[model samples]
Target chain A: MAVPPTTSRTAAELATQPACWRRAADAVPATEGLPRPGERVAVTGCGTSWFMAQAYAALREAAGEGETDAFAASEFPTARRYDRVVAITRSGTTTEVLDLLAALRGTAPLLALTADPATPVRDAADALAVLDWADEESVVQTRFATTALALLRAALPGGREAVLRAADEAATAVAEPLPAALLSASQWSFLGRGWAYGVAQEAALKMREAAGAWTEAYPSMEYRHGPVAIAGAGRVTWAFGPVPGGLEEAVTAAGGTFVHAPSDPLAELVRAQRVAVAVAEARGLDPDRPRGLTRSVVLGV
Target chain B: MAVPPTTSRTAAELATQPACWRRAADAVPATEGLPRPGERVAVTGCGTSWFMAQAYAALREAAGEGETDAFAASEFPTARRYDRVVAITRSGTTTEVLDLLAALRGTAPLLALTADPATPVRDAADALAVLDWADEESVVQTRFATTALALLRAALPGGREAVLRAADEAATAVAEPLPAALLSASQWSFLGRGWAYGVAQEAALKMREAAGAWTEAYPSMEYRHGPVAIAGAGRVTWAFGPVPGGLEEAVTAAGGTFVHAPSDPLAELVRAQRVAVAVAEARGLDPDRPRGLTRSVVLGV
Candidate 1:
């Protein structure tokens, strides 16, 4: 095999992948079966996909609509009981995920979310959701992560559609070009609030994977504790949501730069996604067609 | 300032430093200022110290005692609320942690856990618990990390005397040395159970900070998720506790080498400390005194 040289891709192309995500989201209806309000729902996956599952679980818990727990794919079924399993994998071919899906085959309903609809993980799942919006080059995930999150948002009932629309609109607002303040800074620390804590984690992981950069994520409050000392002049911080003003203030007070995504209708999450894509590009790693990595795992595990 | 040559130190010496940890056992009086059951306790430190605090918090939470939360010093009081603060610092002087202590400024009872008691953190704290064990000379912390955790075990109620006794026994047990399998492995992963999850996190962080190695920490069960797919015959897993037979069997079946710690009294954590210390030494770093580091901070941020 030849060694592949590095490359880049566009987040816009990746965002348009809702058609693929739609297929995966549609499968949820059948594969989701019927989960009781209190039924135990176990969500698992790897890398950013795992973080997405975690975010979904947090949102569900916060909404008070479901009994959900998130676990690393390797740690599932080790403790407690589950009535349903939701596995998110962009590649649809994660080996450990397949192993877990196999174990849950008879034990509970299995829902697999991925960008590659035909991968083994999808095949093993009773239902599949794919956020097919992805770049061909970058090994680290970007648009697919957001689209998958959007699909998760779409799955909720009631005001969820509103949130989805908000997220979509927010995405549009921030996508064209990140403000110079957010894009020009040398470093970033992503802070998430409550249900969005998992989002912060996923953002950090994505930054590391796609950009090979050192980015730290913490609960909004935790940042104020000690990390604030490092927030000197010119440091850039992206605050995830509005709950933790103390954290943002700490960064700003440190003579550092701050970008607060005003609580516009779905503006916060969308702004986060757009800024992340911009950061990916600023690091000289293309958001489109990133280097030496792929969107799917077709090779056997 | 003159540049000093990097020298190696033994794990035991590095771990036993008074400045590196707080021997909260009988070392401190359970006076009025001492934390009571259910009182919110905030643990803060930076980098490796923060990881140790995280492990301690997890353990206390698992033990069903202590209202515990851990934070990177930078995110402390600015992020969360606490009645009592436990600050861990190998070098009694992490700028962020010290700044955190200063910020708290008599707001809550403060306990400084450090290798050096004379440092400003200790001098300013309401009380202090010193490890004075395992002095090392490396920029990367080894023995100090484990010893600090041992000190945390002693601080929790109920098993102080017993756990302290076990620490002595366990410290002696550290004599067995790391397993041969570990010595030969090019890459290693750490897994912890229950509160030990923090240990796994610390181990992974140390690997990165000291050796610039690629490592990860996860709950024992989480490993079976997607990462296990990447596991093969050559992978070495250092499990942090006596996992259930079934979980241990799964790890073995995955074709990765599995090393289990004794559970009779939670021997995994002790052994892990020794393994980490030994590895640091093997890498030609000192377990006693790594490099470019110290046990206390007095005049700096």
Candidate 2:
């Protein structure tokens, strides 16, 4: 397959991920309303933001900071009590996140982690951690979500040292040539484990939102349980982190291509973002303004 | 799509769900080591059993039971501590579940919920809850999972009354004719929220395992986030619980058929099981013996 032209805003936004990661990681100490150590926390967001929240929750839990849960903004559990609720919205205007923050205002210490603190979430949340530098104009989010996750990752046990290393790796990921097969596969399955599972889910979302592709995501080990049944010719199974011992063999036996990048999972995510844009360009679609979507899902707008 | 013959072992197993429900619900009172009221619990399983754990966790939490978490057996966190760990595995010998149980044997109260208590789980878990009658010969599980969940549900706040009601609904579900479109669709998406979200995930797994179909699952509201981009003619989006008001319209606008059944979510799950078999038969496959699958995924078997 020819290298498709990547001229869209999404392409440019995605390419800046490395710089965004570094900046976000540096801003972590200054970010207000962040979940404190030992607090029981629940994070909520929509679309790409939700996937990022999942990554942050897993990272926090794995770091042994506290019990952290992630939910799609609309599906936030009202019955469960948490010490703090963090809402992630790139535009800071998604109705579900705003409504949830509004509803939980008095019940919990509501914190808004968003690209724009000046938006409606200002009144909805008790406090704000603004990342306006990572905000995007593209309907398909690329840098903002990862930047937010990078910031959150810096707050974990490994802190700035780990995120800085990831940013350095991402610098290479952004400039590298993608696997040609990824551009032509008819279907894609992205798999990971722990925090990487959320990255895998975000990778699949980028394929669907930017390229209108058939894509699915799962915890790497869970793929063989049933989903491997769909892995055949013209399909690709991409693993974000360490490839499970026999997964490559399983996918190969099923006549599917398997991809595993040794890059940091966040860095692998950057490469996947590039593939989304290239595939979109090849399909004659605009990754900047995806069909049947808007910059922010402001319902009834 | 002419009514595909349903003579497989999975078909017979699924048909007995209502009876299984009644027996499991009644047996709940006699079951050993069930999570007590206000106890923090974690449910772990693999494949179909894992999805059931998710449903049970959500249901328990919604009933205002103490915090309940679900994890795939392989993904169970070693860092987290719970009052009780519930392992759901029909085979009673899955390596990951057994490993988890063995690891937690003394740390927490270990409860094994399985088809046959005589298996390795008897030694691995501190307590055993047997439902051997619901054991299945088919690789594609239909009855064992629901029956196990029914047992768990009986311990929650509405208990037996609600479960027996759902069993009655399942009685109708097993006998109803599946939608013709479901049999012919080239792709499928199952959508649900909370506990039902897990059921939807299982529904999608059923499609892929039984028919080698292109299928996906998501939180109903999250569907529009990105997966909706895959919806188009020859695809079906089925909802287990309430269809989010505009979801049907959105799926319709994307040129896909939408299915929403008013039956209890468990009952709706039974109907999905039947559709899996029907679609498998239509594609010259057998649901009882899905490709690349075994009755028990005993590693290195």
Candidate 3:
């Protein structure tokens, strides 16, 4: 089966992606040649890619003008109403992504964030921002997830510049002495509320696919519903941003190991990918590139 | 390491309990002994027990005059909103169920349903519906789940006499030529919209916990966001009553199998429980007896 070739790369290979990091950092900017106020835009992706789109919508709403909405690549046509539809496909050749863009034809402006600028999805899009640079060698997503988060953060209003700065800062942090909290945990659960709930699902899906770990994602308070009964000292409960509705307290009482990124709405989009990357590295596994996986596409619908 | 006792029994055993079934059924007409309308009623249980409460709430709503809410044993206090609560502890000793009732002590009326009439939860309840007659040896929950469903159905307005009449008919159907389609190659995704989302949650939780199968429960259209993308070919999607928007066509277009329960809500509850029972029996597993687990108190504050 050729084991699908590990796309996750070690820290050493990751260090070589300065130019790629720069591009990812630049992609989410609110400068010239980028989206403007009231310019109808559509963001679409599959799995974590789509979650990044959601984080973008939330950041925009928080910023007070970025009128953006997210659509699953499969559900875009009916749900999207925009002058330009941004198609975020890492692999560039996922059957559904290609089929969707083809269905849209030239009816609207199409953009692609892909690993391969020359692949079919990018070819379908009117413009492309490639993330192939930060992609990993392992079968899971680490670099790409962070890169997508960085791009969304940069693109959100007010934080546009902050996002780019954070992306660079985040990239640097992954290589530094971040706490090794997640490495020893046997299982992980992503907790989010409201907008973050959707992100939790995608994060859980990514964690399982990338690390071969058993993970579940849920709304924070929903944990007390029965899932909390399973939590104990060694379990990890990673929380996303906007810790609304007394969710953190519920997690604490459940006796779960907890970690959080600040309440920057952008944090939720990026936290999982960043922490997972560092944890993978600490475990002596590569997060930059995963094995038998591509920076762009694998098992994605 | 002794195997846990089963709470499920054969359809034959349920047939012998016609008297208790009739009493619970006939009690519905008087409404004299039941809690007043709008009184706080808290329904608590795990897996199938939770589903039975959901069925009761739905029927109560459709019959147009009861205020009841269902909560997982762990979610009791946070979402608690009743002046009177009914605790459905089948064994009368499920650790969490007992704890949940205790947590609500003094605040509302408590009704306990148990196979053990002398169990603590029953002794604590303002009233008790003893279901000791529906005992079984199966670790899977067959007879009890169905009996709970039947009792709830009989307890609803206009349902008292009808459900009792239907119970014998349902039992006959279970014993007769019902197509034995348990564990179809098709994975099942149970969906209920709005208030029924809780029911969906219970269905997925029970199916996975009891059968160790991959099952999901979500709001009908909410599945379209991401999970639905992977659903196709070998997946069965069941929609509870009052189909949600966009679901009918979406299921068809996605190449997924779909089934809607028959018109009579009580009958639907009856049938769904039958389907679950049939699933347990076909696997040669006792639905009545769960292994290495006990029905006990689950505390929530």
Candidate 4:
């Protein structure tokens, strides 16, 4: 008899990241409602999606696309005028995103990238770019978040090559073993710079959601401010993208392990997801149902 | 023999916050380089000042004072054009702030708000607003951060009254005895909404910097996403502004203490500063000089 697979819904979802990213990136050319070059843009989301929005905003601005700002959907500045507003929601049913989309209907053209196309966002958004293939059954998001960011990344100049490289890296990361330091660390700090800061934030969130882990995220430069005080013995500080000068040495001096790889930041995030799942299994928690969370934050019924 | 004063420099600095706020609010008219109404403004700073910038930016936009954005000094976008750029550096010598000020000399009108008037920023920025009276002897910021924010707040519509009211509340908060629960919490999570989100971030920073406490911060609404997974016994979640609906009950359900005060957010920040000092004293640490930190981050000096 074949051994029953112990893989959780989240682990299965995590495994499909490379393929999902490739599909999303490949579909960007035919997709509509992406912000045009030189158009001022604002991106909004909540939770995991918010981090993706931040990454996309930083990536877009760094690409010389235009000035872009990212905000939590609930905190979206209504007074500010932007040429385009992009909303990222995995479930297409978060109350805050829907409310913002409805509020912005008359003022700014709104584009929504969601995993589910048959939901209320279809009517709320002015334009919809649905990634039905990336939708997940797990409560803790994995593929959908990366797929949304991949779609946005692919829309920018030289974005396709970056996405393809990240996808290739994700494939290798999925099969590789996680570092022993990453498996049972007492605490973790995820650090990133520019666009990668969003990836760092997502990595921290994944640990919290999947394994009830005490994790934190910060801009690589900001990590030195106060958070580094906690970086001693049995803790890990992982950086996405380029490490700031002297950071690794500082963490080492504080007796904390520092992890970095040459892989693309998106691929780095895939490895983080695997760690989250592994940690969850070690703790006897089910990644498919993260404690005290829902698939979507649908407030007020 | 007379008993020597044991009051920490941070405590003394904290004690003067209400007065500093009043002075800064009253001095707004004479304070040049304040961002004007109907101007697109961006504020930049590092650490505590960065949190204050976020507070000011959100407050500015909420006041219908045109679009405003806040960024970490190291992360400021040179590609984006703004009508005005405000850099907050208490020492006026931070490498990142000085670099940005020098780089933005001609492109956009630059404003440097600092406690020190005689510094390189004097040569770098086009305009200067000095709050030398609020400058602190302690390495951890208290008065200057609040005072600078007061100046920014007082420049907005109906701002003086708000600042004056907050000063009065600060006076009360400064005198009151802190709750016993706040003194011994093993871990903390600070939450805030809108402009108060910045206050939450600062509160968490103060705990970490002053007492070596493990703390985290997030927009109040975003806390439910994943961070709350670790919010159990001996952990505290404090909200600077109005508690989100059902959040208090949820945190309580998770066996965590929730703290919310009726005082203005700025006044609430004063109480948090007191907690920082008390925690530092209990841990036999000096708030006057945080570990691995200088008054200003002067890199490569």
Instruction: Write one digit per residue (lDDT tens) for candidate 1, span A37-89.
Output: 66668788876667777777766655665667677675553334578888878
Off by over 4 Å in 4: A1-6, B1-6
Quantify all predictions' global Cα lDDT against the true fold.
0.59, 0.87, 0.56, 0.88
Model 4 C-alpha lDDT per residue in residues B208-252, reported as the tens digit of each score: 888878788999988887677768888899999888887887789
Ranking by lDDT: 4, 2, 1, 3
Best by lDDT: 4
Model 4 chain B lowest lDDT segment of ten = B1-10
Q: What is the per-residue lDDT of model 2 for residues A1-301, given as tens digits with 9 covering 90 to 100?
A: 6676667889888888889889988897787778889999999999888999999898898888898999999888777889999888888788888888877889889888788877898888888878888888888888889988988898777868888888899889888777788988999999999889999999999998889888889998888787888888889999998877788988999899999978789999988888888898888888887767767776663
Clashes of each: 77, 0, 66, 0
Q: How do these models rank on DockQ, best leading?
A: 2, 4, 1, 3
- Encode model 3's per-residue lDDT on A38-121: one tens digit a residue: 665667776667776765654554455444556566545332346666676767776556777887767777777777666667
Stretches of candidate 1 off by over 4 Å are A1-10, A17-31, A130-138, A263-301, B1-197, B200-301
Indicate the worst ten consecutive residues by lDDT in candidate 3 chain A: A1-10
TM-score of chain B of 4: 0.97
Q: What is the DockQ of each candidate?
A: 0.11, 0.64, 0.06, 0.56
CA deviation > 4 Å runs, candidate 2: none
lDDT by residue for model 3 (B35-96), tens: 45545455767655776676565556545545455655644443334766656656676766
**iRMS of each prediction in angstroms?**
8.5, 1.5, 8.8, 1.6
